[model samples]
Target: MYDRKDPYYKKAKQEGYKSRAAYKLKEIDKKYNLYHQNSRVLDAGCAPGGWSQVLLERVKNGVVVGVDILEMDSLNHPAFHFIHGDITEDETVERILEISDKYDLVVSDAAPNTSGQKLLDHVNSVELVQKIAELTRKVLKKKGTFLFKLFEGEDKDMVLKGLRKDFDMVKVVKPDATRKNSFEIYVICRGYKGEQG
Candidate 1:
């Protein structure tokens, strides 16, 4: 359970970010410089709009498109578009493709619904990662970047191995904003080598 009293949580509330997860992307971007002026971004599993909010901050002149099964209240930014749908569905992927030609950056904070059983949760998480990988292949521009949130488990190495084949560079990172006890880690993939439009 996340401590509501945590300083990052407090800072998020004070600064009007929808969730403390905002800082994770901020820190990631600080290190990788993922966003650029007028850059197009796809935020998968964006709920309550925190990652989208951070993307908005970076892409003032660009577009930030978000999609998730959960309903997210509008961020009220001109550059932001929210799609309320399950990203695992073909319709949802089609919707995303319809709106943007290709994304310069694709970021997913998506996690499978936990079943309390660790192994089951890991399997489900890996399934979601596969879906996200397919989506990335279709929509991510060549040489684009993908930042994926993943749980450390037996299947993680397999996932990373496949990602290495798709991207020029693939590495794991645990941002400072992530809970130290959490198994969650971010996989940053750069130079997408997927088919171009």
Candidate 2:
């Protein structure tokens, strides 16, 4: 019951992409130069595999590890690895850490399920962003990059403030592929300072 004929949706189908969300990442990377030829990447909330596909194309020789609670069809590339489980769990974190010591880039497209209550939804989104930030701290290498989506609300500013403490550059980005009516924006942080004194 969605509009399969939407221009982006149609373009995704033609290009063999798993979802139209791929274009969002494409635009972000185009503007930010987030990818390198050999960048170890971690993708959280990566169901349906669009973002992982983009990472695979861009990272070429580096590792791409994607994790989510939902099942995803295997991406089937030597450089690509998928884990099925909640990313917040210790077991999942261990599994990911076992594969790579640290990541050069961490990207999360995670979003909480909205209940149509604006205040409650915003609160939940803020919590989810905090969780992702914690995970990024644990897994990302020093001077790495992070790109995660956050819904606009009062807490958005607070989240940005927290991120600025650790990253040399923290920016808010709304890609062209984002819906005009949506409240979502991506927080891009680079030059991670790491979790040590």
lDDT of each: 0.91, 0.90
Worst 10 residues of 1 by lDDT: 113-122
CA RMSD of each candidate after superposition: 1.5, 1.1
Q: Say what the RMSD of model 2 is.
A: 1.1
Query: What TM-score would each prediction reach against the true structure?
Result: 0.96, 0.96
Query: Model 1, which residues run further than 4 Å from truth?
Result: none
In angstroms, the error of model 2 at 18 is 0.6
Clashes of 1: 0
TM-score for candidate 1, residues paired by index: 0.96
C-alpha RMSD (angstroms) for model 1: 1.5
Could you say which candidate leads in lDDT? Answer: 1
Task: Please give the distance, in angstroms, between residue 35's alpha carbon in candidate 1 and its true position after superposition.
Answer: 0.9
For candidate 1, lDDT tens digit of each residue in 103-169? 9999999999887777888888899989998889999998999999987789999999989988999
